[model samples]
Target: MEPEPTSQRTSANNSTYSAAGVDTAAGDLAVELMKSSVKATHGPEVMGGVGGFAGLFDASFLLSYRRPLLATSTDGVGTKVAIAQAIDKHDTIGQDLVGMVVDDIAVVGAKPLFMTDYIACGKVVPNRIADIVRGVADACSATGTALVGGETAEHPGLLGVDDYDVAGAATGVVEADGVLGAELVRDGDVVLALGSSGLHSNGYSLVRHILSVAGLGYGDRSEDLGATWGEALLEPTRLYTSPLLRLIEKLPGGVHSLSHVTGGGIAANLARVLPVGNWSEIDRSTWSPSPVFRVLNDIAGTSLESSEGTWNLGIGFLAVVSPDVASEAISTLAEDGIPAWQVGTVGTGSRPSGDFESGAKGVDGGAVRLIGTYRDGAK
Candidate 1:
């Protein structure tokens, strides 16, 4: 026993965990890189800044409300991240994440208080992670939500080095009586279609498939789109929370229900928030689908109607309101740069004989269908 073979033991222990692909140092750097952006979203309500084990938000303000209802939503940016990774653009994806998560909370007519993000990646690239978090922070700030805390996880063998996904959960507060839903929808409530920025964090799987079959690459520019395929498709989801919240406040009891036009498409989403047995005929002639929708349909040699269930078409959110205040809501949203218009009216009478989408997402609510031709003459 020559001192327990000290030299061999030293050599055997020399290989570090970093050598196994996990770099604690890189993770630390990433935290440092994203710290400022995360802190920028904080207000006086957020206690104990970033890098905390758990986020602290001031909820004492809820005491002022007669009854405060806490609303929480969690969602990811779907397959949209594929395009972001393809184009090496990490910035806008986080905005899409916030849109997916925080906007859902807004659907209940709640004001978001704070949010936390989680990033899963094969490796920690400080600048890229920072770019992603910065995007989330900016969107959170835009929606008046604090970016309290988040986690950046590195899975060396699980995900690709260049591949990452973003998800977030947000908490919001709304008065108990102010919570919006199908119960508030009336027989003649007007439906307003809030225009979407672009794809807005949904239906990318189909989009990518169509582009791939059409021999299009993310870097390829399309004259119809006025930018590279990735750039056009990567348009960040519009944060409707702030504007919609303002509209709700400005017009008391005017906005009955709000349906975020996400996955399940327009008819399904709208139907989910309408009273049971009540229905709506979404007149397509109200507005035209944007050029992006048209170009993709054209490339796929399919009708816009085909993707109706998979895409938002042009609408991003739907508002059911009293007819008296519908015009005002439209004008208010328009002034806020969100083009909105009357798409249809909730009806309790017999609907035309057709396949109406109802009970979508297991919500046995109302029936909805698209009638009339699109403004662009697409059926």
Candidate 2:
């Protein structure tokens, strides 16, 4: 009998397994496009350039202090990337990734030294990679951190061509004695707060849900928010690290607890510093929130009573500072080109009976709580 056609047999066998979706050539193109932006951000501290098996940072320079404690934080941009993808904006997430991680590490009183990122995509696109790395470089330069390296994995089958995820690790340094947390927070110490640009990485799940109900998508400008939906949602996360690092360098290590405003917002993040039964009650009226918050609030129909337990609203990073230095620190941050503002003073409390107290208002007596916590719209 004639031998079975060779082509038919090969085709039959291959059809069962199917082709892996990732395009190898596409990954190469993506890497090539991002090379320029990547090199520009590299510093002498970076031992080997990008595309290495692992990033190398020679921290001998960081060993100047007798007791150097390394502060490392790993974070992702959260669901905010979804909004970005919706708008076809990929560059800003780079800054978002770096900002999110550095904010977390900085709270421990560490000066961010180096950062590495990981980008995973189902299908690699060159310009998209450029957009992301550029954002990362901007964040690194702004935070006084070096963009040492990162990973770009194109998983066609896993990530889905249109889907991607971004994450980063920021390593910083602080003297062993300089860690800030519940230890330095005391009653009447004053909770100095800094304002946020908008929804800075957290609450996007809620933001998306609310906007969906409102039959809205990003890019619509609402009179209440004063900007297009894309503008507010894509606002790059602010990094207090650069300014805070400079200030903490001169501080007495008494600057106290740092609350990074992220997934939890002000109430939840500040809660991390609660010592034993010590409660943190913030005044919601401390600083006027940006219009974007109001837009979300209106869309979510959120309440003050619920806010303390839910979102950051406007407060970004909370510096548990002494009453005297609070103003100066805030002023110093402003001088550094950061829009810093004092929102509330730290105090003891149980919980708010009436509301989440706003602005620089809250009592530190026993049983701490915000003055007004929205409860079923009663107060």
Candidate 3:
């Protein structure tokens, strides 16, 4: 079918955005390069080709579900890209971008349908651009998310040479009646810890600063690392959708909450959906962190307390479900090649692991005092 006009079609008001450092020419070139990448990932659900004024998808399929809900998440790869640039690695950041997002939707039990990216570079280098695109496409393909569109930007004035930033937006669908999200999270649910592949893209700024002070090479190789520093740091973020969907489908309808351990780590992100008056007790010893966490901790001499607060602490995505189904859910993840383990449980207990003993209702005006991760370290 012929495509429709884009939603944000730009007009020659060139005066307004020109100051924002957006260039029509560079943006145009970037779009050209990304067209194929986007189209390749599209399927019948994609509403139009890449150059359309707006990205679109045929949610017509939603009519079949008794309850239909559309979920969206937008995120950026933080300073982790800086490390990738420093070490001349561009691939994994792509996975990092997807991980930062779709994982959030996964928390709500929404299956990611399509994704678009925004890349800003001071100057376009074929090799560099290709590397990142390769990363983006690879991760998109892995997650079953169609890379339908993206924005490539060139701004020599604003973006310094060899410096670029990456961000992306993902849209997903679920039956309205079947939207599994923080709402499903209850006081008695279980939290499953999915293994992280070596600091899967967060807390890198601190990591770089620590290395800078210690005169350590981010790419330095040691037996402790199993690989070069760059290789370890650049390890792509894991895609949990397939395994997660499988788990949710395999398990009965009791699976309650899902938290994508991202920028906030376990403590912050999990609390987003946790029911008020409820507490999440995450057992730290449930799974072993990959070796990279210790290396970064040692390099930065990060206090264990701070590490728990800032880093993913080796657990990337936490799946919360009814206590009885938690183990089976974790196993289902393993069946699909994802490393998962039971990390914690939900309760009406005390701080960190339980609900706020007393507090006002929350954003939804619900009585809730959310406490995730009480005082135990996931050692």
Candidate 4:
């Protein structure tokens, strides 16, 4: 029974999982390459390490709280990954995932405890997958979250070989009374706008459309941006969990409600965290949107206001705090290097005749409107 010559092997006998498009070996190699970085995010609280069926975290610390409310958030990097893949940059995108997921948890004043990532790719390019996971691991460490486990799935036919998408889920714990939400917001509460690093993880579809219409490639350098278009667009999202957590701990009663300006843009997202029967007029003049936005709007030949429903513009996270502690909160965020400013004040008995963005994202909450022209007068 001599083995058939290697070149003479029939298609039937040559068929394998690899031939079918999945590469188990590359997946294993990816895990191996990403192991150290993943482990670096683990502390004593993380049990069973990587490659586990499920991640384990020690929850005994919650015993110290009279009542613990667990907060969980899950999100993907959105079409922002399209630019990363176009530019072949995998590292920084993971931070965007963390910023989207874990930062959402921080919106409720929760301290992220652990995170798990899921990467779906058309092919398991070991180094590329490893780079993606390593990015996730690094961000998890930065946010004090344990990267206990993750899955790298190969969806060969479903996606293009060079295409991949990353999403993650994070869990955080907060004291029952420490939960920040609309109920905690009050009349005369000052809304502090925290500056975003750039376009976080939303509105990329529009960005891509604008760039496509302008016939610009991600690799093309933008004289106005001072970097490649992709580089400017892929600027890692600012992680606010650590800083917001510090603000909460440092100024116990200074912080009340919080909002992560994502998906729905500023006013809509902020409206979600405001108490019913209350409204706030976010002053656009308080801060100018970063250049990345201005550049894109200029390319698209539209007013910045046109994308207000789709982009964060400039603000990333909004904090509604008691007026007395508003200045202290702004100064506190500044200590953490996050520029903060008063965008609006919560008010009651407001009866505005004009349209307002309220009850967004099925929250049925308060109303918000962007008043005043942008500082740069772009509106």
On lDDT, the candidate that comes out on top is 1
- lDDT at 66 for candidate 3? 84
- In model 2, what lDDT does residue 150 have? 73
Assess each prediction's global lDDT (C-alpha) against the native. Answer: 0.87, 0.70, 0.69, 0.86
lDDT per residue (tens digit) for residues 52-117 in model 3: 546777877777788768899998988888888888888678888888887777777788998877
Q: Compared with the true structure, what per-residue lDDT tens digits does model 2 show for residues 1-379?
A: 0111122233444433236444545555666667666667667877766566566777888658879998899989888888888889888898888878987888888888888888777666767877888888888888778777677766656666778888888888888877887767787677777767767788778778889899887877877667778767899887788787787876675588777767645665666664544556566555566666666777778754455445666677877787778778877877876666555655555644543323221423123345443222111
- Ranked candidates (TM-score, high to low): 1, 4, 2, 3
lDDT of 4 by residue, 1-379 (tens): 0011111222343347667787676776787888898889988887775665677888888888999999999999999999989989888988999999999999888899998888888988888888888878888888999887677777779999999999899899999888889998878889999999999999999999999999999999999889999899999999899999999998887798999999889989998998888898888888889988888999889998999999999889999998998888888889998999999899888557787888787898899999888887432
- Candidate 2, residue 306: Cα displacement in angstroms equals 3.1
lDDT of 1 at 98: 93
| Candidate 1 per-residue C-alpha lDDT over 204-301 given as tens digits, one digit per residue, 9 for 90 to 100 | 99999999999999999999879999999999998899999999999999999999999989999999999888999999998899889999999999
lDDT (C-alpha) at residue 58 in model 3:
81
Model 1: clashing residue pairs?
none
- Tell me the TM-score of model 1: 0.95
Runs of candidate 2 exceeding 4 Å displacement: 1-19, 347-368, 372-379
Better of 2 and 3 by lDDT: 2
